[model samples]
Target: MALLEIENLAVEFQTSTGPFRAVDGVSLKVDAGEVLAIVGESGSGKSVSMLAAMGLLPWTAKVTADKMVFDGRNLLGMSASERRKIIGKDMSMIFQEPIASLNPCFTVGFQIEEVLRIHLGLDKAARRKRAIELFEAVGIPNPAERLGHYPHQMSGGQCQRVMIAIAIACNPKLLIADEPTTALDVTIQKQILDLLMRLQTEHRMGLIMITHNMGVVAETADRVIVQYKGRKMEEADVLSLFESPKSDYTRALLAALPENATGDRLPTIGEIFKGAAQ
Candidate 1:
């Protein structure tokens, strides 16, 4: 069976101006041991869709789906408490900002061990050992000593490694990374992506990478889901999306890539879309 599947999914917020739709009739399927990239511009609802699916959205948000399943289980049928048990254990998320996501007051080690204690029921000593192992696996140097440091004490890359460590503490079957490389240095971004790819393969898990960086999709994704203004524009394998994108929005996104720029000025999204219509 597919690792994750959604049909006729939609999310809307009860905003001051009435209902504001964030995702509309979206459907997708992710198989076990697969890499799926969700690409879109800011406010395109790529992240919101998954957040709603994970039951992380606020109570004010209204989410509906004909079907949403993970590993043969129906997510839509489960209660919030029931879903919570599955989320950080069998399923997990890695956020865009590692430093912000982590507790500033807590030691990095404490935060990571908390996952193990809650999900795996590991004792203090065992959790510590497992936490260190996770840190090391994610390529954090001197993980044994660094575990005692607070979020501010480490660099951006180190904090990200900590986030990954915590997310992978339970060895999740499905991992959703929302703009994981957003604020990192260019080199660090590549390193984080590579680490995620390696972990996904090593653990044989389903990985959902949400980002606007089409280049990252090319590097890591087996399939791509393109979104625009809360609507899905295209779903294709990496090669097909890059080689022959069907949607004008997809083409505009590809045109906006820095690597594809040829002239002194980068082509704006509007310009690309307009040119495509001609």
Candidate 2:
């Protein structure tokens, strides 16, 4: 069975003007030890869809799905408490903004320990030990010392690593990384991607990578899902998707990549779509 599955997922926010749908009829599946990349431009509902699956969307957001299952459990039918029991223990997410997502008042170690305490019922000593191990596993230097540091004290890359450490602390069966390397330098980006891939391989976890960077998709994804304006545009294995994108939107996205540039200026998706319409 697939580690995660979704069918006909949709999310809408109650805006001042009216209901605004952010995700519409999107469906996807991820198998254990597989890397599935969801790629799209900003506002394409890439993050919203995953957030809905995780039940992280706010009260104003109305999420609906025909089927949402994780590890054979029906997520849509689970109570909030039941979902909580599984969310951090069996499934985890490395959010888009690591520094902002972390609590400013507490030490980073304390935050990580909280998850362990709540999910795994680990005692203080065990939590600390596991936290250190996780930090080490993610390649953080001076893991024990860094535990007491606040999020602000660390660099962006280090903060991201801490987030990764927390996400994998429970040895989750699935991991959702939403723009895991966003705003980092290219070197750090590569390092983070490598670390995530290694950990995913080691744990044999199903990984869903939400990113707009085509390079990231190429480097990490076994399969790709393309989204545009709240709808799925295409889905294919990574190799086939790159070599022969069936959707014009997918072709436009690939053409926008720097390495694929063929002119003085890269053509925008709008321009490409407009040309196709003509």
Best by lDDT: 2
Pairs that clash in candidate 2: none
Superposed model 1: Cα runs more than 4 Å off: 275-278
What is candidate 1's lDDT per residue for 1-278, written digit by digit as tens?
A: 88999998899998789899999999999998999999999999998999988999999889999999998999998998899899999889998788999999999999999889889999999999999899989999998999999999999989998988898899999999989988899999989999999999999999999999888899999999999889998999999999999999999998888888989999988799889889
**Which regions of candidate 2 deviate over 4 angstroms?**
none
List the candidates' TM-scores in order.
0.97, 0.98
* Candidate 1 collision pairs: none
Highest TM-score model number: 2
Tell me, what's the RMSD of every candidate? 1.2, 0.8
lDDT (C-alpha) at residue 197 in model 2: 98
lDDT of each: 0.92, 0.95
Q: Write candidate 2's Cα lDDT for 194-232 as tens digits.
A: 999999999999999999999899999999999999999
How many clashes in candidate 2?
0
Alpha carbon lDDT of residue 143, candidate 2?
A: 93
